[model samples]
Target: MEHNKRFLLVHPEISRNKYNFAGIIDNEPLELEYIYSMLKSMGYEPDIWDGQVETVSLAEKLKSFMPGYVYVCGRTRQESFMKEYCANSKEICGSTTFVGGIHAQHNYKHFYEDSIDFIMTSFDMFAIADILCGKSLSEIDGVCFKSGGIWQENAPKPFDAERLPVPDRTYFYAHLDRYRYLELLPCAHVRTAYSCPYRCKFCYRNRLNCGVYSARSIASVVEEIKGIECENIYIIDDDFLVDAERILEFVRLIKKNNIRKKYVCYGRADFISGHPDLMKQLKEIGFYYILVGLEAVSDRYLSDYNKLSDMSCNISAVEILNNVGINIMGMFIIDLDFKPRDFRELYKWIKSHKLRHTAISIFTPEMSSELMEQYKSRLITDAPCDWDYLHVVAKPSNMSVKQFYFHYHILAAKLFIKGWREGIYDFVDYGFYIRTILKNMFGFGG
Candidate 1:
């Protein structure tokens, strides 16, 4: 590959079912922005096409730019689209295609076929830059590529979060309005930390790097926030509210700089429960929404999932956020062991708690998680793409497959109506809802 070759980064279109975007949220392609910035810094002409935002044909873009390299990134659910796009790019432009992201990080072997030329095992920006600069794959720190028809791998280098650059938001200028967190439109994403300190069994963060918690400097984080053009900012940390001192310092920085963007982020229930003052301070500083993983309604499910916190903690956290006038986007996992009564109980619990915004996902033990092995025997399908958490991946223990889906859709519709009553826009067309209901009624999602 030439050192100064043009590069095209493709964010492959994924199934709407996987993310269940339903037009409620369309996250900006922050990962691509990082890569684009890194490549540009190293003197490479790089451009991005976000599948979620861009309507243009990737093939046509490839033909126009005629890049020498095409980089594709996505999660396990997007593996099929990634491979197909890579193969198509290779067929069309004969570009050297490289794959990365969560899917490639843990499952490089799955990408060893001819369609994929190299797989980046770590998202270390410098390592990727080195490879793109035409450095030999063997010399690079975290990549796997074929050498004389044999797949060879390199040990990944330690990622220095301190060196993370301010992302190139200009790339997303055209469709900034589409990205959001509910009503918080034109949202931009910023990362304050890497992995979570607490290990939840069903989470995918641990698989990226086990027990690793690295955070960017406060000044750096604030600088990124200041540079963001969008009114809403989503700190895409696994858990942003872990450290009390850090949160205080961050709040101080925001106050010092007078950065007043509406913020949404992930936080633990225990953190909010223990720090009511901090919650109030966050609200005072424009933290309008907090996405809490109230994973289950029952303590038994919480303990089984190693959530570490109990139902009381979750309730306390919600109450605290409500007191501070901050919206709670409560996330829950549907247990395969759930009976018909369990669904009704959870709905009742949500309603009784006055939870306006909620998100529900089936209990899916994703790729590379420790739970995958235990859940393997009970898996409904062997396809990697089907483990998206949108589908009931495991066999239902208490109800028929159809019955499980029936209750699931009922709850989803109920949540939608509740959100609508609370003024959450049904962003998609009315026909889309009709089609979804029809599909669900016929038991199609599984």
Candidate 2:
């Protein structure tokens, strides 16, 4: 075979059974698209296989494309699938397999399997290009590779969001109709920053990029937005509402350039509560939805999580977003120490706030988070996938495992019923979700 210069990039799918809300929200493979853009600039053939939306099997793609290099990326929940894809690619074509993503970046050792040739610990696409072009593994920075049966890792480099190339977005445009965030159909993912600025003790995002926060200029962000075809843009920043002046500039630029697009982004409750005027300005500039982490209903739990936001702040955030006519996706965490009354209180809080869109997740101690050590001895399951926030990985302090799950399911059911009565989430089939949740409940109990 003439020196094959083709590269295959993959985004693995999550098992529906493992994650009940699998089909509710699917984002574009923005990372793989960036890699694809870089590869194309180097005059190499690159193709993306998004398992989330693509009907084609990885086996078929490997056989047909016969790529010399295969790269796969995913989060902690999709770790098994990432490994499976790498193993399959290696066995099918003997291609050099690589893995990279948020999960792999922090837990690179988790992917030191025989089939995977390299693990990318940072956003260093040039290093990959060099490796493909016959450069030695020792010469690259931000990579882990085996040499003579021993694994060696190079020091990782910090990533600059402003320096990133305009992502090709070919894959995004190809399956534009399939991507979504709840009701926002055909949604697109855009990144304005790398890692997070706030240091929430329970969150793993703040630990990324060597704990450094870098953002692109507002002008650059707006320029990229101009090229995006989708009207619904999901800004994948850990927290987009961090800087006040930057957001004001973004709103000004969006209006000045006459680029109209609805945006969905992650934000902190304290920021929203403190800057009600900015929230109004954001709504005026087409910010349709903001996902606020109202992690708990009590200040004690909030303080324990080091969230630095009180229950009053969360309530104010809900009121502000509601007044501004922007949808508020209230995200809450159910602590392991909760009793039946805590769940009831949470439901009552959501009901009283009149919030139609809510996401309730069990308090999950991620393997990469500093809180893991505190809960390590109390962990009930060693399985990596069980840490997805849906499973109660740690033993509950005030209740049995069965009781915890029962109350959790009851809370979910009550929320779903309320949302349904209020005529929300019509885009999804409630019956299907209910069935899936029930199945998971019984399966977990058994």
Top of the candidates by lDDT? 2
- Candidate 2 matches the true fold with a TM-score of 0.97
Q: Model 1 over residues 281-324: C-alpha lDDT tens digits?
A: 99999998899999999999999989999999999988998889
C-alpha lDDT (0 to 100) for residue 306 of candidate 2: 87
Show pairs that collide, candidate 2: none
Question: Candidate 2, residues 289-403: lDDT per residue as tens digits?
Answer: 9999999889999898889889889999999999999999999998899999999999999999888899998988888677888999999987777767888999999999989
- Candidate with best TM-score: 2
lDDT per model vs. reference: 0.82, 0.88
Q: Relative to the unseen true structure, what is the C-alpha lDDT of residue 415 in candidate 1, on a scale of 0 to 100?
A: 76
Task: Compute each candidate's TM-score over C-alphas.
Answer: 0.95, 0.97
Alpha-carbon RMSD, each predicted model: 1.8, 1.6
